[model samples]
Target: MNHAGPSPVPSIFPQFFAPGNGPTDFIVQDFAVVMIVAAMMMAITYKLKQPMVIGYILAGIVIGPFTPPFSLIKEADTLNVLAELGIIMLLFVIGTEFPMARLRTMGKISFAVAIVESTGTLLIVFFAAQALGFSFFDSLFLSLALSITSTVVTIKVLEDLGWIKSKSSTLVLGMLIVEDIFVVTALAVLQSFAAGGGEFSLPGLAVSLGVTGAFIAGVLVLGSRYIPRIIDRAGKTNDYALLLIVILGLAFGLSFLSTGIGLSSAIGAFLAGVLVAESNSAAVARILTLPLRDMFAAIFFVSIGALMNVSLVPMFIIPAAILILTSFASKLLIITGVLVRAKFDNVTALRAGFGMSTARGELSLVVVKGGQDVGAVSSTILPLLGVITVVTTFLAPYVIRFGNKITLTETKKSDGSSNMEESSSGVG
Candidate 1:
C-alpha cells in the first residue's frame, strides 16, 4: 500500500506557451470574442446614425456573462483590466487638450455650476431614494453615487458630435473637473465614516482632504515645471518611436503614482497629459496616441456594459425607473438653471445640461463598490444602479443630438434676424 508515484516534472517553458492547455488561451479567446462582437455592433450603430459608443456597449452586453444564451467570454476580469487601460488612455488624451491656463480661466463659472449641481442633485436624490423605501445608508450612497456626472461618456459623445472644443464643451469640461474634486472629498468622507463604524470622523476627513489637495498641487507644480522640458528634449530627437515611448511612460508613470497615493489613475494620467501638452512635442504625442486611445475607449465602454446585470432588471425595474427619472430631471433642470442664472445663453446652458446628464459611468460603479467593501451598501441596490446606468448611457447620444437641433434652430433664427435688420437699415 506504500507504492510511490513519480514526481511530476516541472516544465522549463513558460506556462503561456504550454501544450494542450495554455494559461493565456482563454484570454486570447475572450479578446477575440470582444473584438468581433464590438465590430459587428459598432457597424450596426454606425449605419443607424448613432454614436459607436452605444454599439460598443451593446456588443459587450451580448458577450457579457450576465446575458442569456450563455456567456461568450470566459475571462471577464482580464477584459476589465483592459477596460481600465481604456479609461486611462481616454482621459489622458482629454487632459492633453486642457492646459492649466485654460483650466484657470474656467474657475469662476465652473465652480458655480459644480457647486449648485452637486448640492442640488445630492439633496434631491437622497430625499427621493428615502421616499422609495431605501435604508438611510443606501439612500446616502445612492445620492453620492448619482451626484457626479460621467466625464468619459459626456466627453466621448462631445467628441463624436464634433463639439469637443466648443464654448459649451469648455464649460462642461470645467464643471466636470470640479465635480471630480468633489468626488475625491466625498469618497474620503465616506471612508472615514466606514472606518469609524458609521460614526463621522472629522479629523480623518480633514486629513484625507488635506493630503489630496497637497498631492494635486504638488503634481501640478512639479510636473508642470519639469516634465515638459524632458518631453521637449525628446521631441528634438525627431524620432517618432522614441517620442511615443516617452509620452507613454509619462502617462502611465504618473497614473501609477496617483494610484499609489489612493487617488484615481485617470487623474494622474490626465496630469501627465497636461504636463506633456506644455511641451513643443504635444502635437506629435497627440497624433501618435489617438489610435491607441480610440481602441481603449471602445473597450472601456464595452466593459461597462458587461458589468451590468440585465437579469436583475425585472426585479428592480420600478426603483430603477424612479431613480432614473428623478436623476435626469434634477441634473438637467439644476445645471441649466444655474448656467442661465450665471448669464450663459439659453442654448449653451441647455446643451451643457444635456451633456452632463448623460449617465453614471465608471465613477458610480467605483463608489458603490467602495460602499459594498465597507458593508454600507446592499447587494439589492446594485441591480437597480445597473439599470439606471444602462438607461442613461443609452439615452445620452440621443439627448445630445436633441440639444444640437435646438442650438441649430436658435442660431439660424438669430442669423436671419441680423440679416433682416441689416437690410432694413440699408433701405432706410
Candidate 2:
C-alpha cells in the first residue's frame, strides 16, 4: 500500500486456461488411467484366452467409482462422451460390413424371428416382473429392457470366433438389425409415456413411429444416392484424413438427425454405414477407419463396465439371476423355434439363437434410465439389470462356442439317422 510494488506478473495462460491445472487436465488424467489399466487388464485377459471386451470392462471396474480404493474418473461426462463416440464408430464399422444383398435375402426370416423372439420375451418378462410384485408400468419397462439383444457383444464374439460369415451370422445380424429398428420405436413410446407422467398416449406413439419411419425412408432414399457419389470423390483423392472426415461427417450427421427425431443415434450411424457401403469406396473407407473404430469400441465396453454399481448387486441378486435365466432361455428357444418355422435348418437356427441370447446391453440400460427418469421403476432395477448384463456378457462367448458344437453334433446325428432309414428302405 505504501510504496508502488512491482505489478503482479500475469500468467501466460489464465486460471481457466492453464494446460495442466484445469478441468481438462483432470479429464486427461482420467483417460490416461483408464488406458493404462485397460492395457494391463487386456494383457491378463489375453493370456486367459478371454475376449478383449471382457478385459476392457474389467479395467473399468477396477477404476470405476463402484470399486474400492478411489474413483479414477473425476469427469464421468467426458468418459461418457468417449464411450458414445465409440458406439457410433462401432456401429458405423458394422454398417460398412453389412451387405444389403444378404439383408434382402434374409429379410423375411429375420423379421419373423425378430418379431416372435422380441414379442415372446416381452410377454414372458412382463408377467414374471408382475409376479415379482412390479407394477404394470414397471413391468412393461423391464420387459422392454430385457427383450433386446446386445448387438455389440454378440457381434464381437461372433467375429472373434471367425463365425461372422457363417450362415447363422447372417440371420443373427439380420435379426439384430430388425431389433434395432423395433427398439427405437419402443423407446419412442417409452419417452412419450415418461413425458406424459406415466400416461401413454397412443396418438403420440403413432406420431413418433410415423416420424421415425419417414426419417429412415428419407435417409435411405436420399443418402443412398448422394453419399456414394461423395465417398467416390473422396476416395479418388486418396487423402485418408479427408475420407475419414467425410465418413464421420455422414455418420455423426445422420446420427444427430436421428436423435433430433426421437430415435437412436446408433440407428442413424448404422444406416449411414449401409449407405456408404453402397459406394465403390467402402473398402478403402473401412480400411482407413479400422484403427479409429477399434479404439472407440474398446472405450465403449470399458465405459459400460464403469457404470456398474457392484454394491447394489447384492440387493437384487436373486431377481437378477431369475431375469437372466429367463431372458437367455426364452430368447434362445423362441428365436430358434421361429427360425426353424421359417425353414432354416436346425443347426443354423440354434446357432443364431445362441448368438442372439446374449445380454441386452445398451438398449436395456437405456430403458432402465428412461424408467428412472419417469419414476416408473425403482432405482434398484438399474443395478439389477447391470449385474444381469455383466453375467450374460461373460457367459456369451462360452455359450456361442459350445452351442455351435452341440448343434453340429445334433445335426450330424440327424443326418446319420436319415441315411440309415434311406438305406433300410432301399434294401426293402
lDDT of each: 0.74, 0.75
* Candidate 2 worst ten-residue window by lDDT: 419-428
Q: What is the clash count for each candidate, in the order shown?
A: 0, 0
Per-model TM values vs. the true structure = 0.78, 0.81
Tens-digit lDDT string for candidate 1 (183-268): 64576456546645675567866776676678778988988888898998988999989988999998899878876766566667
Model 2 Cα RMSD, 1 decimal = 8.0
> Given candidate 2, what's the lDDT at residue 106?
61
